[model samples]
Target chain A: MIMEKLKLNIKIFFEGAYLSYVGLFRWLSPSTYLATLIFSPLTQMLFFVLIGTYAQGTDKAYFYVIGNALMNAAMSGIYGVTMSIGGDRWDGTLPYLFGAPANRMTVFLGRAFMHILNGMIGVLTGLLWGWLLFHIDYSAANPWALLLTILVTTFSTSGLGLLMGCIGLITRNVMFVNNTVYFVLLVFSGANLDLATLPSWMRIVSNYLPLTRGIASARLIIAGHSLTEVLPLLIEEFGIGLFFALLGYSLFRWFEITAKKRGTLEVF
Target chain B: MSAIEVINLQREFQTTIGVFNRKKKIVPAVKGISFEIAGGELFGLLGPNGAGKTTSVKMLTTLLIPTGGTAKILGLDIVNDAEAVRPRIGFIFGGERGLYWRLNATDNLRYFASLYYLDPAVSKKRIPYLLEMVGLTDRADEKVEGYSRGMRQRLHIARALLHDPEVLFLDEPTMGLDPVGARELRQTVRNLQDEKKTILLTTHYMFEADALCQRVAVINKGEIVAMDTPSKLKDSVNDLSVVEIEVFGIPPETVEKIKTLSMVENVSVEDRDQLQLLLVHTSKGAEAIPLLISELNGLKLGKVTTREPTLEDAYVRLVGGE
Candidate 1:
């Protein structure tokens, strides 16, 4: 039975990828990233490259590029999952999914897993781009550390996206969720700056977040430390990821039951 | 086992949403409605807007859990064995949002077929057959987004039949179709029923219900107001009359006077432009028409017409319009 449900879930996920060309993926891609991923990583690799060079050709040039890309990888799932789900609600297709006979967990994970592929695409493109632009070693990714980083990132961010999806189900607006996540992450995520250099209270706040600990751990691995060296951060970030995912899942399930009960499941 | 049994089924939405963005607004959608559908029956649920047909259909199909009820489809509990129950059912709704807009019609059917866990080999054969059944085989490769309302509705039906379940739940299956399209859809529904497929169809089009359903239920305000064969419901209103009048425009006083006409027992103005039907009654529709016309033309009306009692008239009576 378990195998059957898993296979069903996998089939649903792949079917989603073939959904349409004129849809969220193509409509949402910034076009610049599109050019680089297909063949030329050197395309627009110069923006951050310029940022690094302007900072006086620091050997850490490659590090910022990798960091930005990983940060985007963490966020790309949000872009993919939340938008697709928000689009579903916005378009009224959500009721069909909700009404389907499959388990909510299976359906939720099926859609969630699709975005992981999207996250991997964002990560790989940036990795290749960084390698092409500078002498930075792509081997900086400690295999085990890299996998843990990705797993943690996808879970936590997808949780954030899932929460957004539920909220969008209520509001039926994709633009609202998308813009809100973008700006909020821009400010608190330290994506644009070094976390260690933040104000003391801000640094303290960063330490308490899954994203911050994730970035710090990734940097540690890139600097040649083993996975075990970041054990405390790993535990902390992993726990936060689980918390967000479980929280999002529970909230979604509750709303689902409430909507069904109220007979408002098809309000859109 | 009976194809469907719903006993003392009640779904009450908490009038108020609570906590973590749970705003409290309780709206009871289905209230203690109970009925049974035998195997191979083409059952119809007819209701006006806000009648809770969708909610009831959702419950029976295992899409939404009942707040305080138990329903079994093919002897599988809707809640406890939903996954097992799902394979035994297929559902279709005509909302444009139902199909994946990006996928072609055939791909949409194939995707749903996979969810039913049909063997790949079977889908390869079944999809073309099912699409042909709905008459969309030629356009099956085009994205559903490009299909007209009728085409999409056809694709939705094809998607519903992909798994070939014993029971089907269809909400407004022919809602947006034209006359020819609606006729084809009703025919398709009848064909499925002939194959012993149990069907639950909710539609505002009483003609569809009357033509295709062997047994029908009418729900209003979240409760079953009436249920039985369509003929019986219509027979209950046997002495009823339906009057239709076409006028350039009606005057307020003329409408008021028509209500007081000797044989014009009850009269109400129907705003044809808005497509809102109003019910008026007299012992005989023909007896009242001349008076209805003189009163209308007396007010300089262009034309007026009256006709027989219909499923629409029965609907008005069931909804307690009289």
Candidate 2:
């Protein structure tokens, strides 16, 4: 009986993810995905690579490319999760979702699963872009470590994204909050800038951010480090991700109860 | 056990009232209302716009938390046992906004079926049946955005019935449909009634309540002003007659002048395309028709007729002409 229940819950989770993807893309044209998902990230990569090559010379181009590549995963996770909830609110379907008989955590985390997967896809595609454009060498790197880094990074960052989506329950204008979070992740996740370049306080702040540890580990793996060499960082990344996922889910439930009491859940 | 029960339910919302110098105002949306609905009973809540009909339904469905007092659905408290209550209830808020316009009608129903945790085998059978029942089988695969308003409303009904919930709450389910569409939807609702589901329907249309509900509660300003069988409610205004005047380009002042008459019990206006249907209730009946004509001497009246009172007359008399 327990096994059957778990299986059912898992099925519901995947179905929720699939439905969310359909909701996100049903009205969107193909060209819009080509522009937003593909060309846009590649252009940002090219621009950053060019600047890094010019400022610090050709040697640092690989660092900048890999850094920006990993950040795409974070972007997709944040935008995907935040927009999932925000879009429901805008379309006036949030009330139905709230009134559903399903468990609240299952509904929310299930909706979030696709965002995490999309984030990993973004990271992998960005890496392909890096390898094709910058000729970044990964022949000596451990493929397993690289894949693990991408998965962990996407998971952790998606938790933070889910948290931002929870904040969207109170402030219906999620775009503003998402944009602010996106900027913070870009600047403070140790992606574009080196840890030495940031002030001591800022570097400390970067430690607690979603992608910092994951990105650092990814960089080391790209530089030919073994999975064992980066075990501590990977562990820390997993812990952070789990912490955020739990925290975000708790906050989501808290916000839901409060919104019901305040009668603001469907006001938008 | 009663299918639904409420004791002194209250809900107040804080809103900023002014533009520049905003003052936080506490609006009592549902104020100290109490009621009971028996199992398998078709009950109606009749009220005007913002009369807290939707708020009360939302509260009962566990969508909103009440500020004070308590509500129980099928022996489960709405607040403390919401999860236990949810699986047994379904609701459909009127109009097309609630549907996913990108997905087709079948997908919409399938998605909600999963949300209600219906098994795949059940949804596979139930989805097609619901789509056929709502007369959307032909267009079930078409995206909801391409659907007409009536079709979308029917699809909303299909989505609501996906889980075969024991209790159903419908808020203004026929608000914007054409006459045919409204009648078809009402037939579907009547079929559901035959299944003995406990239905709590909130509608402003007295005829709808009179036709479908076994009993109704007339609410005004968040309070139950009247509650009884449709026949009993209509009998309250049995001595009154409704004089309906279909007039084109009737000025507002003329309608007011008619209302100010000593014999005029109440006046309600229904706006048609270019003409206005004025329904005036009075004990004088045909005796007041000539008085109405003389009062509107300048305007060209199209057709004037007097008929007996309906549930609508009882409603107007109870709510004092909203």
The fraction of correct interface contacts reproduced by each prediction comes to 0.45, 0.64
Candidate number 1, chain A TM-score: 0.79
Report the number of the highest-lDDT candidate.
Answer: 2
Please tell me the interface RMSD, in Å, for model 2: 1.1
Off by over 4 Å in 1: A1-57, A131-156, A171-192, A211-214, A217-243, B11-31, B65-71, B76-84, B265-280, B300-307
The candidates' DockQ values read: 0.41, 0.71
Residues B134-238 of candidate 2: C-alpha lDDT, one tens digit per residue: 899999999888998889888887777788888999989999989998999899899988889899999999999999999999999999999999999999998
Model 1 residue A263 CA deviation (Å) reads 3.1
Candidate 2, residue B164: Cα displacement in angstroms equals 1.8
Report the error of model 1 at residue B289, Å. Answer: 4.0
DockQ for candidate 1, please give it.
0.41
The stretch of ten residues in a row with the least summed lDDT in candidate 2 chain A is A20-29
Docking class of 2: medium
